[model samples]
Target: MSTTVTQQPQHSTLGEYKRWLRVSLYTILLLTGQCTATLLGRFYFAKGGKSKWIATSVQSAGFPILIPLLFYSSKSTNHDFSKPKRSVMITFYLGFGLLMIAMDFLYSCGLSYLSLSTFALVCATQLAFNGVATYFLNSQKFTALILNSIVVLTMSVILIALNTESEDSTDLPKEKRLIGLFCALAASATFALQHSLLQFYFEKVAKTGVFSVLLRLNFYPMIIASVGAVVGLVGSGDWRSMGMEMKEFEYGNLELTITPILAVFVFHDKIYAVKIVAFFLAIWGFLSYIYQHYLDDQMANQDRSDDGLQVLKGEEQI
Candidate 1:
């Protein structure tokens, strides 16, 4: 009887279980943060918030929380730091940090005008952007399936734009909407490119995938981003109005009242035929990618198992 290696539990070891737990916990945190952050940002705008810079800075300011994780990962072994000089490392981290700040600003700009649904659907194209970046940066070959995914996802975005009638309840001017659209797409592209660059550099140059290295890559850049945001916040003088903005925030009882309000609010997203079509089309595109990922994982596992069998058979014969 052949041993089906694929049938093995992924988290068979204690270490594997811990890793899986960490991953699941982080995934949940990320999802919660993404949803609440966007909801609050848009809520600010819907309630007459005029300070985009403040909103942008808020995103960067959260980097401090990563500090503990950096310390927690300090003991992780097998990390490969880039061999470049200190200056080079500093420059690399600073550059990416600035890119992140720019992305945050762009996202704030989008939230200023676009409806949450419209902005989110447009931003969802980042996965397709990552696919393109992987092809170019990681030397990943673009098969017909990848091309189809890119196309279908692109069409989904277009349909979202066509569903313009009920995009944002705020009803900002058309020029404002156009600006928001551009900013949203640009933010998505920047996000995809930033992560792609990090992944490519670490895997190719650093040549390690340890948790410590990954943690360092995250926290270091965040420090730079936070500092940069502070400078922007001070220079733009938006901080002057920050106190007033906070005091006057329409959702003064945000923690107490906003959760249930948004749950019902977003659920009532005005749906048009175009939006329905786009929604399903996006699901189709995402599902296709998921299935392809499963196949790749299976193939990789099978190849490893075959090599293991060959080694065992050779040892037995000897």
Candidate 2:
């Protein structure tokens, strides 16, 4: 009877392993799709035309699509928005949004100096930044795994920086290009902080679906971004000239416009070896995260089951 019981548990464990595997695979595909879309958008932005507007335009215009997803997720999760710690949520958004603005503004200049592939690699430093920021903000002690990830990521960053060659034939100072990398690092830091803040909110305050939380989080920032975009256009004195005659700029979202521009002006071709490697690295990192999360969850479940079994056994013995 004990052997049969053990076999049943083994079968159950196998089932969970399979389920987690499937989820991990699905998550990888989702990440890849999103990455592809973002890469295409970046390409358009590099094309040096009205396509630059695509970034802000898509951000604002995509609110409608986001809304439905948010609503459905909130319903599915049974998340009570009203029960959230309002003060904490407010502070989080305020701090995160300001950092995002600063990062974006800083990169607005750096983008002029760096190549798309270079920038993409620079952005990947966020994983390391998140670890550092979490230590400072949450006072979380790092485990060996986290420390190792940071070390590996740091090495990758070094490799990428060393590998970068100036393709721009313009008379821009070499020092300015070097400075662009630091700016990109600063942007990555801000992104990491923002993510850490959101993770804190979801775990510590009120557990909610990512879709709902993201929608709510984006609401104020989107307004700020829209205002900033409008102001930038006016301040540049190119308000009248920008995106007016270009048939490509007619779309509600700028990312779509940016895609073609990037393809034509910046990257100028299909996938390259380095980019393919980067993509795989990103996917691997993402899978590692999912696996770690699943392991934690399994341990928690095992602890609960053990506790329950102990109590039942105690009653039987009594």
Best by TM-score: 1
lDDT of 1 by residue, 18-78 (tens): 8668977997998788887888788778776888887887786776787787777876564
What digit string (tens of lDDT, one per residue) describes model 2 on residues 1-318? 345445856776888789879988997997776466556544444544432333444434444556677667768864445557778777766665566566565554445456666666667777778878887776766766566666666665665556444343322476866777787788788778877777777777756645667677877565565566566656766567655635444333354645464443445434445555555565455445445556667887798768756766677678
Tell me the deviation in Å of residue 122 in model 2: 1.6
For model 1 the TM-score comes to 0.85
RMSD of 1: 3.7
Q: Can you give the TM-score per candidate against the true fold?
A: 0.85, 0.69
Given candidate 1, what's the lDDT at residue 78? 40
Q: List the residue pairs that clash in candidate 2.
A: 43-262, 44-258, 44-262, 54-254, 58-254
Candidate 2 overall lDDT versus native? 0.61
At residue 266, candidate 2 shows an lDDT of 43
